[model samples]
Target chain A: MEAASVLERRNFNGLLDALTARGYRPIGPVLEAGRIVYGPIQRDSDLPIGKTDIHDGGMYRIADRPDDALFGYNLPSDSWKQYLFPPHSRLWTATKSNGSFTVAAEEIDPPRYALLGVRACELAAIRVQDTVFTGAFPDRQYNAVRDDVLIVGVNCGQAGGTCFCTSMGTGPQLTDGYDLVLTELLDGDHRFLVRSGTATGADILRELPLTPATPADCAEAEALIEHVSGHMGRMLDTDGIKDLLYDNAEHERWDDVATRCLACANCTMVCPTCFCVTTEDRPTLDGATAERWRTWDSCFSLGFSHIHGGPIRTSVKARYRQWMTHKLATWIDQFGTSGCVGCGRCITWCPVGIDITHEVAAIRTEEAVHAHR
Target chain B: MRKPKLAVWKFASCDGCQLSLLDAEDELLAVAGAVEIANFPEASREVLPGPYQLSLVEGSITTPHDAERIQQVRSESEFLVTIGACATAGGIQALRNWADVAEFTRSVYATPEFIDTLDTSTAIADHVTVDFELRGCPINKGQLLEVVNAFLYGRRPDIPGYSVCIECKRRGTTCVMVADGTPCLGPVTQAGCGALCPAYHRGCYGCFGPAESANLPALISELRRLEVDDATLVRALRTYNAYAPEFRAASDELEVTG
Candidate 1:
């Protein structure tokens, strides 16, 4: 199939029709309970079109946008993890009768999904999770769903105040890891600069009505990506960051963050790439059968590291430290990438407004002073 | 010979910790083969009368009934293993220790007088002798498996007792506190979680509890110089394992001055 592109009103309904006709379960952003959240899109009308979200530490509110664009904001409270790694999933079942026991394995069947308007930073977060779930032992459940996903990456035209994707080296532009990349170009008529990175994506583009890339469209897309990249409100110096955090374990900065941090695990929960999980069991009404299930877990929870006698991270200070260190420093060793994609979700959803970028900069400055001494 | 019988018990908690055992999807079948699940009410409706070989208890003794029930559980089980921060420490509910119980009871429930509860929620160890205790707000399943396996094999479980710093080093995870000046509890926390928090670019809140021979005086001195106030330090220590001896002692020493 030859690669092609199609132009619609650049509104929600047009994108929905394009996604549905392709036999994909369209998932997009919608306003729910005064906040933007990712959920199933029945049609274009379901999306939060012409809507922008106001976000800061401990706050998120939706505001009306003048332009009726499908992808208008950085991110909402929900991340891609909600669909990929669900909050709870049954793993297996067990049954026993008359001293004889048998086990029943639960089958994992992920729906064929079309992720619409995925921001560049979120794409980076998805890649980080791909490495964690698929790179190592290969989580059978995660792989089952992730394999059939059709990702539609969108270039960020506007950066959120909390956004730091530029520093994470994973955003502002869709470089790779997508079926189709779209750059929204509003030139009198709303249009998109669509490019295909995979054969499947090319096939989809072939089916859609699209014009060959004009030099002006290409130039606009490039300029938009670069402009958005530079407009990032936050930055983190990854250079020697792992060593800086690891070597100064007793630094005084942790106490500062711990004071405000509720240790609510909301940051980890909302984080697109945080994949820590724990499990539970439920027995059938008959009491003859039992099923075990897996659920999302957070390091911030005192129970996450509970051992034989007590919790390892007994204090709020310890839990906070463990979370930051693992995300930035240890993540490099575990996944060969920083756990944080600098999506800014942690900062926005955090009830106390603890900004990760500010925390990293503080550490950097402290290290610099120590170096001089 | 019949396989050893295993039982799971819960007390005062969110039931999240006991759920960790059931979360071991890959090893669930293998685990079932090794033991007879005798009394896990959360997982099985069939309550096999115990003289259980092993009992995995979650949550803490927060009520009079729970305090008495723990003794019964200890009497019925050969091996009693407490799981999660609630079972090993007092858990978040232990925050009640710092406030007036009557006021708290009135705020949450309508008939505070009818609710029979203890002034302070305490770990199982305070009521009965525990064979072992798993640390964490929710204990890690991998370590849980090791402990169960060790009991089955009649040997001591090879669980690490050093600080989380060692696990971070062994896993080649950089120290967030050292490198980024992020405050971390890896230096004082017991290693079991494989240094999960540090790997995720966050400071340790000591969910795994205190390590053996933890130098709290030094940690406090550094924190103080770092401008950590006594109230903040006290609140930090009195989290999941607020009742655990080492943590409890440290937090007690940092009581708020009027």
Candidate 2:
């Protein structure tokens, strides 16, 4: 049953307490370095209440929102992927003795997490990663943390200057992929209109000091989502975009973008579903133990495409094309869904203002190549 | 198998890169066990001669005498690997490359006649072929160990050529340039120092030098958009690895001398 309840902002800490009481370490968006970052939060005060984010192409700043709303920020610099699919993880270790060695698996059982303030786009991103990690060949590390984690998704009450969740069809509303979803109602009463998406969510909500949400409360929540829907900071024309990317493999826009693209891997790293990783055997100088670790690798890295002799995608143009095409086009073929969740972290976090939306638009326009020349 | 003989040599540097080997304190024990220290004047007084399996050169070719010595050192070692910015990109001393050495000596030194130095401070690669080159101002000790370990095991040194942005993202450092409007060189600077400056809320000094896809002009334009002046940007590029081809070229292009 999708039971909706009204949770007072004053008693939000009780929700955190309920989760913690049930042995869940809550991870949420906290203010860090004048930016919103996903980190561990113990109580309500830990959340960036009264703060919202200002995000644009290559620009982001956290500013005081007019009112105090806990989940006021839209997209955080970090994705939920870092918690599930960690950037650096040891896969295995080998110890040597008398010219022969034995390898052992680095099996680990991580703690259960209650991911609070997860956005709809972030939830969608998690679902995409779930398929990537669990399908065909499963990643042991990802599945270990993914299985028992509880997600507390927050619907978009505010949209940043880089948001395009409306176009991506991933957000502004929480449809699925969350245990409990919260819609922070900041109008007159500082309260949250909470709903349970799953049985666990219902149980958790039952423990919280919640009052029954009226139809008006639900309607207001719906209206807020609708308002956010019309206020997307960015938009993309995804109509036949997959085919367009496939056909425009030789587009000169790639070269044009290359001139501005740092190939710094910020986009892929900030991306919720970019799962490319490279493993290195780190043997200590003593020749005793060697750890084989798989760290997050990006196609932007020249070494990412390295074979026996040298890297295949050596040029910035080739790397940029590979990332964009794979993300927009080939990813659908591989995972049956577009890789981008429209969080716009890639655009916001890039040092240069290289907007993927603009790139797609440029490719779609017939005169874009001619205009570039 | 006999432990490979390792030699550490210096030319023109602050010796911080040489100290990085000593700074690998716990790892130094492992390094000592793995290789025979044939020559390391900084760490030891006793020096063993020639035909070393590995030579870790730590400085730039700045003097006429050191220029010929590097060639002699190159011939004695099976594999010659440059250890820091000095060896890889001529370090901060390479700032002399743009300035007149005679004028510099006359201004800084009491006796200009005794100061016999090359006008230009060039990287080891400019003088002799380098088997491998490690970047960074002082070089990361962990990476230093990894390089040494790789050579011992006969494998390719897995040094990344990506920007500091990747490292910042990996380590969960907020993008200083994007988030705080701080003029950072992380996007153009190579990944090595674990995005150190950004973590501390300071812009990257470009100590590790230009990345594989620096795209300096684009980065500079963005920095300019952030209201960073050309003089400050040029100063950022002319730090530790000033003579690094990409940084040098970009700095020269953007140099706003009053």
Candidate 3:
């Protein structure tokens, strides 16, 4: 793959301008409401340049970085799922009148999106969603948006307090699933080491002002990625974790965590990979027409597992157990991978700061002690 | 044939349970076809006069007006089915029952004199004769269909009142409590969700409320032996269906020790 470099911090803006010129809407991370939110970005100024985020369970705050690094930010509160599988999207519409029912197919106009500054973990999360929404049944709506999306993955030069992508084997560096991968190098010169994983990214690189990467620059990028990985704030022992969680369902650690869990579902809501959703119908002013919409759902909601006459997981303890188990254990069965991306968003965003990594560790340690005894 | 008149009524809830009925996309059209939908205000603006064949009631009776309205709904409906935890068993809002109503009113409302709530949020069965009760925080659509289909076919609904453990066994899901030593409510929870939590590798949270013949004392003892604290046990029973007699009894039992 061809590689190049761009020194113009405004080169990102130029790329957006070029994309806009070529009739593609540029969507990327923009500073919104004290947090980095994914929205339409027209220029480099819209990017969270030199701005980093402090992410913990349920809490997200944006902080200013000392340097003018455009792609220096960590994962934002919003994931690419918002663009692919939106919170509220019309699936279809139905009308009933005159003793007959008429159904109209919803006009799904998937906007041509250029996702700028997607972190590697988020890219991995997108791939996980792809397997879900596109793999088996191939959700037409999700596929429509995803098929046209141009992914611009930014390698993490800085890790967030809540980031554990290294543990999940998904992030801190961009590997694939992106049109372009930009590594912001900080060696006296302000430049981005651009690498193309796809032909589209190569085409974009070809269009941008660039210089051939020296062997030293490539080494610098690799060293930077390694440094970021080493500095991961948290880690999870995923080896045999599925079996461990599957086997220790009676572990007292869960009960301890349950005491603190408010069951507010803030963790699942902020989770980049949590994909459970439910649909509802809203009637217009006229009683004849109704619109069906899909919304994000959480397992923590007692209503999520309600059956004929009652909820299956009526207790907060049970709901919390279901969520964690699905994320860690059963996710392996369903998706052939852990549902959790080790992003640590669940821990940071949890109202009571219930750390999944800590909980898992406690369970494992307790089990080990029991076995030794 | 004229569609059966369908009425959706709310008592006291977060509106999430009623939202579940509207959430049915794949079956909503078919449901509409099978019913007149005479008074579903959430999904329709037109409120036709009801002598409804099927009334899907959400929430619990938490006020004097609601207590009266439930009777009217029962009188006007052939089959009155309560949906969700609130209707079947007083919902999480039933947490208000633990504290003094006067204190609660004073805390929540600026003018307690204007408040018209009852001392406690009680299930629909407490006020009127309910034909059926769908369990859940938000009723499961699959079981909701089973209830509707049974009514349409003029047969008894085949909703299982057995423990969630049965469903787990049927689904070949390993017991998280047994295999993993995970504290679960599967042994006491009514089965209807087909053991989703267990299938997902988690313990059952007893969302289906209590199963018939639930051995609460034994389960509580076993949980304690497994190192579950009294506070944890109490919190578990005080969720969605906390006000239900069985769960309420179990929670009260736990509270006695503390």
Best by TM-score: 2
lDDT, residue A274, candidate 1: 89
Q: Write model 1 residue lDDT over A1-373, tens digit each, in one string.
A: 2233535553435555666787889887776645567778897678777888766554556778888776777786678888888777889999978987688778876888999888888998988899988885898888888999999888888888778888888888888888888887765577887878888877767666666777777788788888888887777888888998898778888987776665556577778888987776554323467778886667865667878997788777788889899999999988899999988888875544678878878988987898899
Candidate of highest DockQ: 2
What does candidate 3's lDDT look like per residue over B1-258, in tens digits? 676888899888888777777788887887777777799888989999979999999998889998898889999999999999999998988998997899988988989999988888889999899999899866777778768777876766756565665455434343455434578887678777777897876877888898764657757776776689999999999999898898899899889976
DockQ scores of the candidates: 0.04, 0.85, 0.04
DockQ of 2: 0.85
Per-residue lDDT of model 1, residues B27-101, tens digit only: 787788889988887789999998999999999888998988898999999999999999888888888877788
Q: In candidate 3 chain A, where is summed lDDT lowest over 10 consecutive residues? A: A279-288
lDDT of 2 by residue, B131-166 (tens): 999999989887888888889889988888889988
Interface RMSD to the true structure, each candidate: 14.0, 1.0, 15.4
Q: Which stretches of candidate 3 lie over 4 Å from their true place?
A: A57-59, A95-103, A281-291, B1-258
Between candidates 1 and 3, the one scoring higher on TM-score is 3
Cα lDDT tens digits, model 2, A1-373, are 4868999999998999999999999999998768889899998888898998888898888889888889888888999888999999999999998899999999898989999988899999999999999999998999999998999998999788999998999988999878999999987888999989888999998898899999999999999999999999999989998889998889988989999998888999999989999998888777688999999999999888989898999889999999999999999999999999999989998888799999999888954456588
- Model 1: residue A156 alpha-carbon error in angstroms: 0.8
lDDT of 3 by residue, A74-139 (tens): 766556777777766788899987988788877888888988888888888888888898777889
Give me the displacement of residue A216 in model 2, in angstroms. 0.8
> What docking class should model 3 receive?
incorrect
